[model samples]
Target chain A: MLFSIHADGPVPIYEQIVAQVIYGVAAGAVKVGSFIPSVRELAEQLLVHPNTVARAYQDLERLGVVTPRRGRGMEVTSQAPTACRSKRRDLVRRRIRDALREAAASALTPDEIRNLVDEELTAVNGKRR
Target chain B: MDPIIETHDLCKRFGGKRAVDGMSLAVPKGAIFALLGDNGAGKTTTIRMLTGQLPADRGSAKILGQDCWAAAEKLRLKVGYVPERPRYYDWMTIAEIGWFAAGFHAAEFYTRYQQWLDKFKLDANARLDAISKGEYAKVGLALALAIDPEVLILDEPTSGLDLLVRQEFLGSMVGMAAEGRTILISSHQIGEVERVASHVAFIASGKLLLTATMDELRQRIIRLKLRYEAEPPDAAVFGSVLQTNGSGKHWQAVLQDPRLEALETLKRTDGIHDMEVSTLHLEEIYCALLARKV
Candidate 1:
């Protein structure tokens, strides 16, 4: 239910919502068959237009990540986590691609970029430990 | 999609000053559209014309396919208008005023409106003259919803409201919009409107400067800062540059719809040292847009 966004990002807000929800499912943050807040509820919480949230919900439904329950409102589909794995991987690839692009722009060689990535991964792991 | 409200070249003058001049706008159905402008920028006049409260001097406005001026009685049934600082019979209590206002609708509507009144927590017995500005606003909202109106025209609905009341008012609007009611709200509260409004129309000195979806506005109006080796003379490379000014090496430029090519051009340029792109907030963008009377 919590997501961060760059308002100026090339990706629109509705897409961000779809990607964030999918990421949540694939990453174990959102369990399968759990209830996601209704569009109005999410819009108020995020302070966005309800239509925006509704569009995201519709996209998620189209992607089979969420399903409409007759009485209980929207719930994540049972197969959503598996369905979202590829999208989650795509998100990871985008971040890695961005980092590599930046490193290339900074004139780093492949070996130097690998070392930088290794150092960053170690730091992240250390924090986790 | 058919617009719930449409106006064409709507003109209005007050004491030789053109309050609304050649204003044309379309509010899409089910959209929570915000008409934003500074005071005396004809927001009130436009709202008046749209709601059929005041006739336009020239041109026309339509709400729900009925001419706003000629067919006001018919259109009033579908549209609920709440003007700024709504006047009420001071002698009447909230309950009395509500009952009086409900006379415009059927008894069933009045029955359904009781829930809304409860939601707003209005003391029906309290005199209108004795209530706070926020309480009076709640009364106004209660009556407006009493008819289950298809369109709600709110002119500065949250102007004098306190923090909690304003929050509640905004919450009610969200609920109403979810029910598929078209809302045209005019307010100076850019931050609040930015959160809820699907579309925005910026008016300055009786003329519209921009009308766009909130997302489009955020993406299109951008501010960029660049540091160059010397006085940068190539701001035109950025598409639709609005204004640019800075001394020798550092220059800041505001642009509309700045493209990636421009950024790439700046990046590859020899003299440019740094470039920063930023999205302006609605308030800042409004000021920048209206600064030159455009």
Candidate 2:
């Protein structure tokens, strides 16, 4: 239920919401059938436009990570965690591929690319620890 | 409750000059409403009347559905205010001042006090007089939030803060709004208000100019840049020309309309090579409204 959006970031707010919700589900922070705050409530909480939250919710519902009930608010689905985990893996692979392509274009050696990846991994692991 | 705050033809007169004249507004439960105006546009006078700090010369105001002046003591506990220039006992530390204010409400001072202090990044031991203006503003905000009143009235909460501090204050206010607390903030920081406010009430020359949702306000006013071959297009065809700049080859004007008819009219004019239509920012709308009043 806690999240922050960066206005100056390259990722749009809707995408950020989607990413956070996915992360929350994958991390088991949001359990199945847990009632997420309403779109209006989350929009007010994040200080963003309601439509932006609505767009994120719509995307989440379409992807089967969350389901909206009549008169009730959105709830995480049972399949949400696995779905989010798979999505996260795909996203990370896509980003790594893109970075590798750039490195190749710049004539960076494989060892140099691997060293850069290792440094990033170490930083991520440090944060997690 | 009826409304957290309500006014009926409230007027404040200083000698022959009217600071606030026949101003009326309603703040609904748990909504972040902004009272917007220039420095001398009666915003302060209206807040003073609503908070019962100053009596109105004519008309009436109610806070928490009680008469603001007659029942000032009863309503004081229900409302928490951070004035434009917060004056505290200069000798007190941040913690002492917070606990002193919280004592009035019989609240558990340290729990809410520490939470607010940490959120605002204020040192618990800092003296009120020793901190910078921005840090003092943080302490003022922390004090107000610690009270946990149903209605919060802030007058230019981040008037003197740098960009980062301003963002932090706005973020805190936005978080409070999410908890269903009513807030009425008066500020010249149009962009921040536009981000957090659900409704905006604009005042000019001691009169209410417009009150609308952010979406409605954005839809009402528009910026138009017109490029013509040799002569500038006639502005009369537009609904109301808010501003006009540039000369022969090109010109720009802000137009207000319920629809795009004025834009279409300009597009149909002769020698009009290009015309760009876009939304107006809150500052632009405010400037246009004040100019119209003048």
Name the candidate that leads on TM-score. Answer: 1
Candidates' chain A TM-scores: 0.79, 0.76
Q: Model 1 residue B284 lDDT?
A: 76
Those runs of model 1 whose alpha carbons end farther than 4 Å from true positions after fitting are A2-16, A69-72, A83-129, B230-233, B257-267
Evaluated at residue B122, the lDDT of candidate 1 is 81
First chain of candidate 2, TM-score: 0.76
- lDDT tens per residue, model 2, A10-74: 35567899999998998788899998889767875677656557778999999999998888999
Docking class of 1: acceptable
- For model 2, how does the per-residue alpha-carbon lDDT over B1-294 read when each residue is reduced to its tens digit? 586788989999998998998988887776688999888989999999888889989998997778989998887766878999999997999888887877777556557878989877788788989998999988877777766778899999889789888866776676666666788999877767776676789998788988886666666777778788867866657767777788768788777663476567668878897788777767878888778767
**What lDDT, from 0 to 1, does candidate 1 have?**
0.85
lDDT of 2 at A111: 100
lDDT score for residue A67 of model 2: 95
| DockQ of structure 2 | 0.15
Model 2 spans with C-alpha error above 4 angstroms: A1-129, B1-3, B107-110, B228-237, B259-273
